[model samples]
Target chain A: MPKPAPHIDILPDVPLRLNRCHEACGPGADAFAFTLAARLNGPVMWISESWTPAQLNPVGYSQYADPAQLLMARTKDQTDTLAVAEEALRAHAVRLVVTELTQPISLLAGRRLQLAAETGQTTALCLIPQGMGSNAADTRWRCTPVFHQADSTQARWEIIKNKAGTLSAWDVRWDEKTRHMLVVPPAGNRPGLADASG
Target chain B: MRPVDGPFALTLHEANTDRIYCLNDPAEGQGLSQGMGLADARAFCPDLQSRPADPAADARFLRILARWAKRYCPWVGLDGRDGLALDITGAAHLYGGEAALLEDLHARLTRAGLQVRSGLADTKGAAWAIAHYARGVAPPGQTRNHIAKLPVPALRLPEDTVTALQRLGLRTVDDILTLPRATLTRRFGTDLLMRLDQALGDQPEEVSPLPDPPSFAAQMSLPEPIGLAADVMAGTERLLAQVCTRLTQQEAGARALLLTLRRVDQASQQVELRLARPLRDAARILPLFERGVSAVDAGFGIDQLRLEATQVERLPARQLSPLHAAHQDKLHDLITRIGSRIGLDNVHRYLPADSHIPERSYTTAVAAYSDPSGAWVTLRPRPIRLFPPEPIAATGHRPPRHFRWRRMSLSTARITGPERIAPEWWLQDDSWRSGLRDYWQVDTRQGRRLWMYHTPQTPGWYVQGEFA
Candidate 1:
């Protein structure tokens, strides 16, 4: 049997997931990592196929300097970069780590991220292949593009995978304009549709 | 055959230039009859290599020589195509005498494989004339008599002017000097008298001493270019320290800083850091530059590092407020920190401008640099958040009860205005041709509310903002 991955203690009473995800996974994984970084107010490791150190910390974040917290990388590689990224994820004070190119991860990483988010704890977003699934996750999500309500703008969000939840999975919408997720009405309230207005 | 003693004229005419101006030739073909054209000159002497003229390269070489000559005198200006005029009044004594300095200049040029003629006089024109005309090296104080004997061409006048003088039977400068000054001025124009006056040092001619352009910048050229971010940070720190020292000496602080990285290939990468307030402290500056340098794309390697402070204001030693020294310092520190992170321009404080127009009354400028409180003015009540005026479709115009904004409808519950805001006739803006605006506060069914106004002059209504 393989030895359990050695874990570094980031915060008390927190479990860190250190695993690598495949590079084929695009920005859906990256968006999750960034969202967690903003929420955690500390460093998170993110491993992806094409990423520059510059893209991680944009000039805009300079306004919110060190006291506000910063994202940092401990170690990186093709297979284990995601694992190290997970190390950044599971802390109360520090929330998430995103790793790329390890054992195929699907619902396991998603569930862990969702669990952390449910408790208002820091979440880790793992970018793995489509088929990788584990029974350990609280929720598993697949991100896909959707049309914006007002204009021809296209936006994408995770396709929710939940083991225990009352919210309908298909009706969830993430508004890019307002940077918020809104529950789309089962029958959307379209005044324009009622009036037949262009 | 005896060689011409003392001095004789040598013109580097195109055809004979190569043969006569040959490097390391003991007898440099001077005085030997080689006529005007290259074919004729080559016929006179075989084995002549005709190199194409490179004027640009020749000019650059001359400038390099000029830089080296700064050791003799600080004030040096290039005279015409092939001449250097040095103001050696006080410097002559340092080189023992004018004769020794002239000898030294000749030897230096000779060692550099260049043939040169040098002269010293009270005036530049006289010295120039003596060097090209009378003697290869003129003695001090003898330029007046030496130049007087030379032809009018040696005065450095145009070819046309020389021809005109020759037409007037005035071939030599002595002939012009002997003519009445009024006659020379009237017949040949003021150019003749001007050149004569310049030679005798009657008129004051100014040499634009290259104004050491306000050295607002300090830089260092590295022995070898460096690519690492750490190296750039180190260079930035050094430059900041130097700049801070300069700022301190001037009792000033920099509000804006420009850090320039000159790469090995002569390409430039610049990072600009703007501060909320002018500060001279090195601690505040170094970290800002540390953040700035990290973003600089060090393509290949950076060979030169330069730091310039563009906007400067006096940084008076903070006079500790007896009431709250700590608070003021802390506020100043916070402004510096926040300004460093975001751009200084992004962080602003509102101050009142002298105008009646609601929008024009207040202006935003970098917070710490500008006064926060504005003067009290009696005018129309201003909205907390003035959004871009969105056009609204309404009926029965005094003030509509409800209007749609961003696809949401809001109904007016209260009307508080007919606030008359007039546009300043002195200042003209097409948009504010709106003579007056009557503002109203409105509420909506969806727990949303907004502030809308009616333009009385144009007779139209606009939704200005929401009560967030």
Candidate 2:
């Protein structure tokens, strides 16, 4: 088995699927994405659809990753978006290739992307909306915004599925001073809810 | 040459008419004038040989000759179909003098089996007149003296104007020049006066030379016509190599290249390639022409191939680390391939803008031209993506507990307080007319995260963006 990379502690050396629990959890996923991309060695390629209203703002993203090392492609459709991501992975230049799809991808497409990532020794992340169909991804993570305190940057991430069959969760807070995500322990030893029951 | 030779005086038949468009010097010597009826010409020179006139071939040959004349002077103009005008202003001293330049030009062309006549004068009009009417170089400042003896037709006036002047017994330029300027203008109109003044150097006439077509172009004429794709590719590779060499020497790269194939059947085909980034490497540029080259019909067979860089740009010096440089090159190559497949307009990159407003904080620019710069001010949380503010049906002055958005009735699970973002009053934005906004991060029961803001002035709540 391939060991997980030092900085990328969430999954092994394989492509990961990030499923957004809500429409508003996009920022949290992007925050984790940039953190993961920053640890990689080479440049990054971000592919998205042209109709996507919210794009990766370089100004905001640059805070986490080197903006100069980032390349973007706005594809016309979902197929082109996935193709671009796959091509970027196979190019062996980008350390990470991120793509967002309006609809869920097929198992074949997911396997193809995974194969390309393994061949190029690169990481791939597919950002999809909630309740999408399953694919052959190594790990599936669902990120949701945790609204505990006002003006707090906290997110709850649940590893719903993993290739190793291990399930875990974390209440992650973005530490502005350290510029790294800190895993917050459960409060008062109370049993932590698997889902946001607010 | 065959058309001009034979046992008869040769004349060319006009394409659309039965009249004689032009006649060889031998036929002209036999009293066969141009624009004469074919029957009349046949009668005048009982053994008159006639062939159809090809104006396209004539124009093409003239253009080629004009290009060849560039060896003498940078500025060469095609004077009519059979004549060439060269502005050898400062280039006269290179070949001894003005007289020697004309002699060399005439002698070289005559040796090339061409009946060449050249004239040198201060003005283009006088030079043209001397070239056709008199076959020698005219002394500088003696244009008036030299052209005075030439006929009125030598002034390049309209045929009707020349005939009208001839009717008035003004058969020569001297006759018109001797006449009073007012009478000449009144009788023959301002055209006659303008032509007379232009020839006599009284009025400045700008001889606008034809635009030198392509700055970087290489051409090869094969001994035999090549119909095979491999032969055409070989020819193209040679041209590309030559052009790329020149580009490298000049420290420039071509942004667009044009390949013209002249077939033996007189039909020409062109293939054009537009590049995303300027490039000079022939090895890299050759494969790009495969699609374009194969698309060329190559009707009959191509006898001539010309490669030209229609658009060029100065290549910036690369100053990156070795590792990063290789990655950058690969990225650039990938972008170029994708851009060539789709289009450069489809590739975009975001650049930070100097604005505090959420929507105005960034701008989109073509990826080829922009590089990421500056730091993102993340003093407060900003959504990964922002949309046009959609009004939400909510009933509350404070943050609403439940709202209807996108046809979904959802209850707010938790609400973060209104982060008041005041409008920038200095700038007039139509969307911000509501003055002040109090934003809240709303988490709904349906696991949907939304960034909604309450416009105090407009007294309404709207969904501005969504968290990832």
- Output the number of the TM-score-best candidate: 2
TM-score of decoy 1:
0.43
| DockQ of all models, two decimals each | 0.02, 0.28
Best-fitting candidate, scored by lDDT:
2
Chain A superposition TM-score per model: 0.51, 0.80
- When candidate 1 is compared with the true two-chain complex, its DockQ is 0.02
Q: Stretches of candidate 2 above 4 Å error?
A: A1-7, A11-28, A59-63, A66-68, A131-134, A187-198, B1-214, B217-238, B258-274, B286-308, B316-323, B407-429, B443-449
Reproduced native contacts, each prediction: 0.00, 0.37
iRMS of candidate 2, one decimal?
A: 3.1
What docking tier does model 1 reach? incorrect
Q: C-alpha displacement of B364 in model 1, angstroms?
A: 35
- Write down the RMSD of all candidates, one decimal each: 18.6, 15.1
Local distance difference test scores for all models: 0.57, 0.75
lDDT of 2 by residue, B1-468 (tens): 543573243346556447877666778788777778888777777878877677788899888888888888888878787788899999989999998888888888888878787788888889888988997878888888999999989999998998888988988889987888898778778988887777778888775677754358999999999988888999999999999988887789998899999999888999888776788989978877776788789878999999999989998655657656666666766676556545666777667777778888877778776666765566666766578889987756676877788887878878777788888888989999988888887877665678899988879889987764
